[model samples]
Target: MSLHEVHKSHRVGWLRAAVLGANDGIVSTASLIIGVAAAGAAKDNILLAGVAGLVAGAMSMAAGEYVSVSSQSDTERADLAIEKKSLEENIEFEIDELTQIYEERGLEPNLAKEVAKQLMAYDALGAHARDEIGISQTAGARPVQAALYSAGTFTIGAALPLVVAWAIPGDHLIKTVAASSLVFLALLGGLAARAGGASIAIGAIRVTFWGALAMALTAGVGRAFGVVA
Candidate 1:
């Protein structure tokens, strides 16, 4: 017989970037549309704002994710380099360190030392990196992956409200956009939660709440400015 198990841990990197990008896309673009519409802007002007926001926000997300994840990757590489040097200079010490770590995790001393020795003999740097430094290939940072996921998801998310606004350019544009955007946000939250294995209702509610707040605040500001103008 054979046994297998599925894991979600590997999805953390790209999943986080995708969710953040999509959420920001829907929220910011929706808010911009609602605000501009509330301020008595024409349909073309409102959509133009949304288009501009989508472009700027997508670029911003891509650049930001790339830079941040690249920094993490750099740090990880630096740490690995140092660990490699340490292993070369003091191989025995490295083995003992791995043994101690295994012992701390409930293995007997003799067995721990044996296991560490075999593992280090097989791949010293890899053993230390995994057990001592907690870096692994599955969870390691990838700057290009994060950047592409963020930019792609942001564009998809931002397009939802933009499409809605374009479709219904009438007196009820504000109501339609706001309502539909909330629905889109709730769906996004639910899907993201499902993908991340979290409570769907909670995720949906939290995302919707923040999105509503953002749209409301922006709308209020737009209305105030409209009144003044």
Candidate 2:
């Protein structure tokens, strides 16, 4: 019989970006709409604000993810370059380092040394990158991928509340937007948690909590300013 195992670690990079983008999209757009509505803004103005927020938030998420992940990618390249040079100049030292690393992870000294030699012989830089520097192809940063994932997810997330605000009419716009947005946030959290193999309830609660807080604070500020004006 053959055995198959599944792991979620490989999803770390894109998953993080997707979840963050979607969560921010829903929260920010919804909150902005709610705040503007609370301040006695007209329906047209509220919808316009929501549209503006969606565009701005999506672009911000893309740019932010790209810049941050690019930095990570740069650092990784630098580390790999340095490791490559060290391997060329100090091949023996590299092997000994790999051997010691394996030994620390519970291999016998001789066996570790032999395994290190075999691996280095096959792919010296690869061996050092994986075992010595803790960077692997599976989890290496990809700036373009991160940027796309974040921007795409953010647009989708932001569109949900924006659509709700557009569809509903006056007198109940604020309540409807707030309620629908919270539900959207909870759903997003649960989906993200399930995708990442985490507790659905916990994920849903955390996102909704922060989202609710953001909307509440924004609404209060808008209401106060509306009263003052």
Tell me the tens digit of each residue's lDDT in model 1 across 1-229. 5596777788999999999999999999999999998898888999999999999999999999999999999999999999999988998999899999999999999999999999988999999889999999988999999999999999999999999999995698989999999999999999989998899999999999999999999999899997436
Question: For model 1, where is the 10-residue window of minimal lDDT?
Answer: 1-10
Q: Name the lDDT value of residue 130 in candidate 2.
A: 92
lDDT of each: 0.94, 0.93
lDDT of 2 by residue, 1-229 (tens): 5596777889999999999999999999999998898899988998999999999999999999999999999999999999999988999999999999999999999999999999999999999999988899889999999999999999999999899999998788888989999999999999989988999999999999999999999999889887435
Model 1, which residues run further than 4 Å from truth? 227-229
Global lDDT of model 1: 0.94
lDDT of 2 at 45: 90
Query: By lDDT, who's the top model here?
Result: 1
Would you list the clashing residue pairs of candidate 2?
none
